[model samples]
Target: MKQARSFDELRALSGNWLSREALPAWIENGYDQRLELFHERLSFSAQPLSDLPRRLMVQCRQLYVLAQLTCRGMRDDRALIAQTWESVKRYFYRPALSHRWAFSIDPDGDVADPRCDTYTLAFLLFTLAWLYRVQPNQDYLDRVDEVLTLLDGPLAASSHGLIDAVPRPDGFLRQNPHMHLLEAFLELHESTGRADYLDRACALHALFSSRMLWRAQEALPELHDDDWQPARPDDNWYEPGHHFEWVWLLRRLSKATGIDVDQDVRLLLSRAIAEGIDAEGFAIERVGIHNQSAWNSRRLWGTCEYLKACAAEAEAAPSESEAWRSRANSALAAIHDHFLQTAYHGLWNDRLDADGSRLSADVPASSLYHLVLAIMECERVFGRVVPPSRPEPGRMRALFLDRDGVINVDTGYPRKPADITFVEGAMEAIQQAQTYGYRVVVVSNQSAIARAYATEAEVMQLHSWMAKQLEAQGAVVDAWYHCPFHHEAQNPVYLHPDHFDRKPNPGMILRAAQDLNIDLTRSQMIGDNPSDVEAARRAGVSGHLFTGGNLALFAREVLMPRPISEASK
Candidate 1:
């Protein structure tokens, strides 16, 4: 397969492959008619028709995939997702156990494993969160609250932050469940905007950093003792896949909670790529503390995790973004060549031997969730689709201006509000833009905060003062965005070499589009720097250079329609 040269190409290729080819094949071959849900496995010769005990994790995972598809503009799956949810409610949820979900259910609709598993519960919450996002229902929210209550009460172990697998000490502990718990909390917070969910997620992140992650070796041990320590310190086992997974999760957490985990994320990705990946670009399953191969087999899901880690690293490290993007493309190529070479379109080899022979004969439905997530990350990083809480559809235009030179004089490091002075005719330009039905906004790069020359509070104060000054002249400034990041920043907290929100990254502009409901294609950005223009280009918007002189004249000339030849001239 040919490699993708740009993010747009990558997004188009990935999205189309999933939506047009892979997903349809899954729906056609993965569904079990008698069970009224997805089949556990589909062998090349025959489909399993027997009603066997299926894990609740599988059911929830399938439901989550269908719900995500529906949320992403595939409206045809809504009915199917709803029906699957009904099956989950009927078979998986045990009303006798305080409405706790069973671990697995038999063919006769009996609870095969009545034990309440923390990992299974996390997936249930995650599915419910996505279902609630697609179709807002009070019932789902109530169930979420009830599940949280049970998890905190009856299922809670003596350990402060740990939940039991079977409401008793089975001498088992794993960080996998906590990882999914964090994912669920973040999804809940996204759908509901609940501070409590964010608080819970923060706690899980703390657990990961302190207990789960072995900082000395830069590894995340899979098995843990009851006290949350590694089961065997001398011969510890780690999965490169888990490290890759944590890399992406930590980046998400840092963005959501304002925590700085860049150093840790970098370390994890670097080590995972260096030691976990084979020479053939496949991600191996398990390794020891000394980087010895424990399980030499490569799994499909492991490759997916490696791809996602590369995507996340690309976004975080701009200087090396191309290298990371290339790595992602290489992983994708490996998946296509080794896993998807079967006669069936969507049927992928789940595992491969060390020499690259297929180990599994049947296709499992659980792997779809992993592939979908990796594709979704590609879509998000490439700006193919807006975020889940997208702006309402409209044709509203906006005028984005840079503050330092466009709005005010380019006085370097203006810390005090008293030193602020508006450029000539800048106030008139703002009023005129509003008169022409355009939202006026300011987007600036403030490395001063990173350099410790000014505090964020001081910058906000200056913006407020500037807004007040504009209000006196019957003008308005709709919103303000600034980046306080620099690679060589003096302040440790603000030093980010590849900060996504910095100029030339387009994060602030994209965020403004989401928050203000601005039509980026119709909007225009005015700045004095080339980086500003590049940022607008990346955001899929038009950018204009402001080379001084009357701001009102520049605004009028740009906003007004002119003849093609005259305008070009």
Candidate 2:
């Protein structure tokens, strides 16, 4: 079917729904203030399903959603995320069961399901990673060590993907939990600069490449045998949503570890796009790969996964970026038309039948994990639909680089593509900074706008192009801050004497720190000018004067150093 709305419009609608409607609804009703835990589901009217049993997986997912929002400055739920962390420990965590958390708990906070579910545990770990990223707490770090130790030991192991059920009914080896575990490990690595998490994530990627991937069918097996082979006739199915999810994860892992998994990513994405998505832009819930195509309805979370994969694919396959982007747009439309159209308030329709009917009466809280991350990926690709949040503390640290001499040679206000010349190892330095858990923020002084040589819009356009170029090279400049006003401005509108944002004043650096919640104590600024150093000093950040040579080496040797934890030990 044709796309119901343009990408910008579609994303705007989603963003508005999130900021205006869903956020308040979920925070007010979906979270139990008295109990200090998130509700398992919301009624059709957006009220909490207060009596329902709460799953540990759902609790962790909701907390993760809030943590994502906290990181984005969408909401400062750091206090709530931490408060509920304790609740999770009290309600679900079983210290008696070798410190394994229970699967589900009732409304009264009694254990509903005592199994040490691998899926729930992965989310728990995932939540911890995100929480720690928002604010580095030693407690969260220690907990991560505890969880990893438990997993690496004999208790958390399973034939496939760890143990979903404690009793291990028929020893069902599901691939889904393993996928989440990989995600958790990757995030853990990024959050803490821990090598073991990266190594563990690599191990999971190898598992996917070797056993879980159904190369003959170019698909992933929903269930695998104990021997790591696809479980046949009885389990015979493929979740197309999962194929798309794996595409995103595989590319991410490849970027992090420099592992060559793009081939597998291509294979999985190609098959999923070819057979999984219907003509209506709906991602089929399950494809009966054994010649039995029995799909009853689709899920909103599936389309969310589709959007995420499309974003990743668009980046990886530049030759076909247009097609992948088009698919992503279509996925958003599918989500808007099919799911977000519900008049009542199950955040968005969780499930829809083939004839476009809502299958469920309440919204599952667990889907927030899929939707929040999916929407963020969409924003990253299609540009942010929401407004830029104000700067505040309690955010992550950053590595702020001055643009002119550091990112590109200062050829006196270079505005055009040809005028740009990247400093040595600029890209590698950015990649390294990100790998070591720092947001790469680019702070620059663009006096060209004030001089009337280039318009503000033109300068911004160039910056956008520069950012895209850097991203294409696997070096992401997370945020950009530029001061366009100058005291000697030829244009009266741009004439501002001693503008706060100008480098020597520390305005740009300070604004960026506040906007992104960059911790100045941990952040460092790299630049070639004395003004850059002064600005860094005023902002309470360390400054490094780079006269010449490799920025990558400077970043590694001076900024990063051996301080990054070798968690492998």
Candidate 3:
């Protein structure tokens, strides 16, 4: 397969078929045909509960695949996006609220297990950040900040790495969660420009590059003790997905930092491809570094992530990027051919023999999402580009958002929609930005929710109301992220932990960047408070702090053509 020069060429090549439409070609044409190959074989032996984290992680990956898929075709499917977002949020937020049920049922909160896994938390943070992009909710922003603060308090180490990757109560360590943490932080850093967030991202990048990547074997050490010393190198015991996944992250870091990461990406990706690739064009599931034959069944997620990594490499080093991209495309082509059957178009957890023969199949929804994201990324970067439905001029947007005094009447910790009031010209300012193709993102903080002054539900309702009201005025927010945790509050929810997402923290602004896919280095943040200025500074957003002046006037003045007219030239 040749690399696509444009998205149009990509569309023509793929024949514009959705993965579902393309799956039958995989079944009738490809190899692997075992009935029970993809799904885990049900045996008489009782399944271990400890495997929950791994299972959950897989589920999260699949959800990502679905999101990518659903998001691809719809330019106006707001309802579909909202529903899918709620489904993913159910996994994260439901568990978060589980504590309340424990307190109610036992009256003493004696359930012992909090259902909080480090892997779960890390995954949750990633999802939350993603959700904010699609939905642009402030409550999600607060939740992300809240969750990370909790993790830092319990999982962070003075030695500059997260504690051995364990969920609550055990205090153990693991590589998967740390890797996820690095991924989530990198996302957060890109969304907002807080040095601390970037610093954390760099620190984790260093930790993984220097400490996790096996120097001699050019592989990742699966298990680590509390101090991060490798407990084992046996690949069978760990999934191969992480290695491929890390390749993508490393490449993303390299791209964001403008640093030469070809060597690192090549080192990791080449090893994965060499060890995992098969004659069938699909990579093997698990392979021992030295054993040469301890491979597990090639699974859907491993292949999808490997392709994702390849795509990332393609993006990072375009010159030689095609080699990896070709391998990934081949792997995905093989997967679609062999794994998918006529009954289902999604992924199957079919077990494959070492020779790439399928033994069984269980189409898991979780694996579906990663493939969706991988394909989506490929499409966005290389797929055909039709003229947009609406033609608009791009603007260097300095989102002149009116906080409390400008958009809504500043009710301290506004608890309800009834309390909301829009300032004059606020809607117009938002309209102006949209007209010019400047993304409109709201960067605000509501410490009142953390202060026990308001409930989470109410805070959510308030945001919902705000969005609805804004939309009513023909203004849409591309993204909105807020910090609810305040330093001082009566309620535990309100009690402020010095979090990075807060106004001064730069979290909300950063989140906007990630969600809107805006170039923060070229964007501006307009707010009313010193904290807002600081938030802009933290997020690397360039803008002016506003006061009781007219935002439209400010925008007009700021947007006026420079004295050096093109006519003069």
Candidate 4:
């Protein structure tokens, strides 16, 4: 089977799309040439829908979306960001209404929704954070402080957190805005490394932990009462994408603070991966918090969120990276297959139905932020991806083992199938090696044929039988090698002064590399004797001695599942 692209390779690949195609396409066509604000959606024909009301959320998302590309050094559009920030000021920033930003603007550039929602406010702060990162202007700093004062004074919630929105609706308040506020605070903290930003994050995180992060339901509730109590089970639902998004957010927060959130992260990740991602690999939009049922609607951004979560998990826990990175690669593939392509180049379909049919024809420009952030995180974790090529089969690593002592009880070269006794942890060790991307190859010094204790055919038959038994037990040995020739041989055909294939020489390992297309440098060997170590040295592979213990435990240590204690840092 063909190996998937490595995480770095994915980053590079996606980075190209973001820089060369997607961002540029959006720059030229996604923005309203006349209005200067980003259009909320683009038609399938690649035309911007200009008549729709402009949202503060879309403006901030677009500002951040454009600035991120420049921040990553993919493009240098400082002048463009500055120009857009000017428009952001002219359109969204309200001077008359206590300096609170307007929620939306009509086509005539008049304030359509005066009541500033927390979602819009959070995104505006997120934009300012990026704006400051690109260029630390005094005005941007002043604006951030002003927004913070308003949030703490007027928009503040009943006790601690901010209200869902001003002109508080009789409807249940939302957890979505708080999630975004947490995200905004994290961005600010990361950009400035200020204690105040971290403090803000801590408060929001505390609110999330106490209220929205529902451990019992294995999902965060989307709706809550004004007092921060979760909505009734019957009316409550959650987005699996948010679950994935939080995994990345939590990991970032842990980096800023020395707090350990590994357990919580793992729990949220496990539940989302299990229940959120469907059989086809798409992240479903909504799941009933009460019934644990999912909606058929799937968004392109959700798949990107899944990629972000997996990448974060992989970075946080190196030992478990194989599992997490594999999922990340899967998410990328799903993205490439479905969302990244369009009728127009660099444009994407935002939503899909159960059968992968386009549910929404218009692309929401807000989603570009999600997709780009996912690739950016991958680059941060795995390094920037570059051009991809087919993985050479010969470059694959293997776990080479001495058959008798390593895989089974060493019973003095007993050749009969009935004499075989598999070593404890041997089968599990083989499985574990494969889980970590190593092929298991067995090389045995079967000198019994030379001693005339067993015929060559009999030993070959025993090996075949043992392989079958191992396969049945889920321990698949990929290839096998045996040396029939020996120095002192009773059988004339097997007699040799010095057989090159014998241990303490590199012949068997070299032959295995040639026959099985193995990469010797990356491969490892485990045997009970010093000769095995010497043979591995000659073969240019690392060799480990297996003492009397569970084979699985010994191999695990050799594999080096290093804890990522400072991975975030």
lDDT over C-alpha atoms for residue 392 of model 2:
26
- Per residue, candidate 4 scores C-alpha lDDT tens digits across 461-497 of 6777888888788877876777676779886556665
lDDT of 1 at 364: 81
- Best TM-score among the predictions, by candidate number: 2
Kindly list the per-residue Cα lDDT of model 3 for residues 249-329, writing each as its tens digit.
876766556556566666676567667767766666665665666465677667777767766766555676558557656
Ten contiguous residues minimizing lDDT sum, candidate 1? 384-393
Over all chains combined, what TM-score does candidate 3 have? 0.55
Error of 4 at 336 (Å): 1.2
lDDT measured at residue 347 in model 1 versus the true structure, 0 to 100: 68
Q: What digit string (tens of lDDT, one per residue) describes model 1 on residues 1-569?
A: 54333333344345555665677776777776566777777775435534667889888898888776655443248888888888888888778875468888787778898887888889989988988876789999899998788678766656656655765546657788888888999888777667899899998888887777777777888877877778877787888888888888887777677789877786676667778898877899988876465687999999999888888887776678679877887777767668766776666788999898999978887888998888767544533212222223234789988899999998898978767778888999999888887888788898998798986657766786788788789878877777776889886556666655577778677666644557777888888899899888987778989999899999898777678998799
Error at 389, model 1, angstroms: 19
TM-score of 4: 0.66
Residue pairs with colliding backbones in model 2 are 391-514, 391-515
State each model's CA lDDT, in order.
0.76, 0.77, 0.55, 0.77
Candidate 1 TM-score to native:
0.68
The C-alpha TM-scores of every prediction are 0.68, 0.73, 0.55, 0.66
- Residue 516 of candidate 3: its Cα lDDT? 44
Cand. 2 TM to true fold = 0.73
Candidate 4 residue pairs in clash (backbone atoms < 3 Å):
8-385, 12-385
